[model samples]
Target: MGERLAGTVADAREAAPAAPAVLRVIIDAKRFPALGEAPPRHVLGPLRLTLRAHEVLVVTGPSGCGKTTLLNLVAGLDDELDGRIERPGQGRLAYVFQEPRLLPWRTVAQNLALVLPAGPDRAARIAKALAEVGLAEAATTYASRLSLGMARRVALARAFVVEPDLLLLDEPFASLDRATAQRLRLLLLDLLETRRAAALFVTHDLEEAVMLGDRLVVLTASPASVATELPIALDPAARRDEAAVAARTAELRGALRDLGSLP
Candidate 1:
């Protein structure tokens, strides 16, 4: 009788459906129309990618390879592309652009509040997000007064406060000093650990890519397409080790070299 019951349970599990992808991108092509003396330019070739829940997919490639354009397309900021973007269900999304892009006139708390709907719990939510990013004391600080690093932290807090299902980050660490950038990266990893949201990150830094990405998507030059997809299997704890990260970076560079996509 026990054996029969076990067989029935196994059969039920086998019959269950698999979960759908959080997002799927199938971009056939993207082009810019002629302007004055400039002729039409193709920015992206056929490309396909998918994002699964709690995954961090980093997109990196040569300069002018349409990495930003790809992110914009996935974020639904562009509709001129040839193919379609499939998001399975109605889910909240957030974007942290290259620049902090905070309104200088607003306070840090106010900045986070803009993304959230007004309610009695709004203030508490803002406080919790700020605290997670180590900016609890900066709640009332004006965006204009905070330094670049602080501003980036505030932007990150804003993205997380809404509890997005998908988070899109475009070079969030660009232009910061190494120490500051490292700090922010670590903070981001910690937050993602707790939140477990699917993230699509774009960056030019190989080291940063090696440290944060679960999978790296390398693209070809202008009129970009997928050159290769490299899965990074380094243990999460190893991401902090210089030797581990350097080894992985070297491996990635070699892969790019083989594809002739190295920048």
Candidate 2:
């Protein structure tokens, strides 16, 4: 596994055409005004990193490490900054927020329809997406009627409907029960592998990082910065249940301590 990743890294280092079209992020400096009073606070970053076309980059760190802030920049939600972010293709991008930000007024299916491209056969796509998230039965239900986990699944389905080249997920499985969260993790791995979307996922869970990242990027607490990008040493197939999960958790914990992201 180490040899394979080394080869992949070597290939990434090779020079490509002068006008490299791959999705890359080179944040020379990204600063924004702080939220509260007293002092002129800011989420600052001369932060730098890159996410290749087929990478699943997991960002983790101490509380207030600016995880969500970084995700927003990647999502094009925060443009009130100065930096350069090169997107791989002109293809659409999609985001799954921490909350299930579904429109209360619309039925689950209708909410999903809002993001999918206009086409003659969008219903089929919506159905497929809903099924992928195990929400096919909730298609007719109002957003108000679904449980939090179900609602988040709808948010996920909505994001999936876009068929994005880049998918930004911000703690999408954070507030769920273990069973549900695990199910979503498996589903996510399936989605990421099958669809081949370059994804950047932000989470505080060491286990999640271990299970998902091709390389895990750790950050410092608020006013965040990249601390390390450690290679996750586990087969993607070892993503389920106790044994592999526990081992990965141990490895990740040791790594976090070494990086000073954990106590």
Highest TM-score scorer: 1
Model 1 accuracy (lDDT, Cα): 0.90
Q: For each candidate, what TM-score against the reference?
A: 0.90, 0.87
Tens-place lDDT digits, model 2, residues 231-262: 77567668655588789789878877886666
lDDT of 2: 0.79
TM-score (C-alpha) between model 1 and the true structure: 0.90
Candidate 1 off by > 4 Å:
1-19
Reference-based lDDT, each prediction: 0.90, 0.79
| Ten contiguous residues minimizing lDDT sum, candidate 2 | 15-24
TM-score, cand. 2 vs. native: 0.87
Superposed on all Cα atoms, model 1 deviates from the true structure by an RMSD in Å of: 4.0
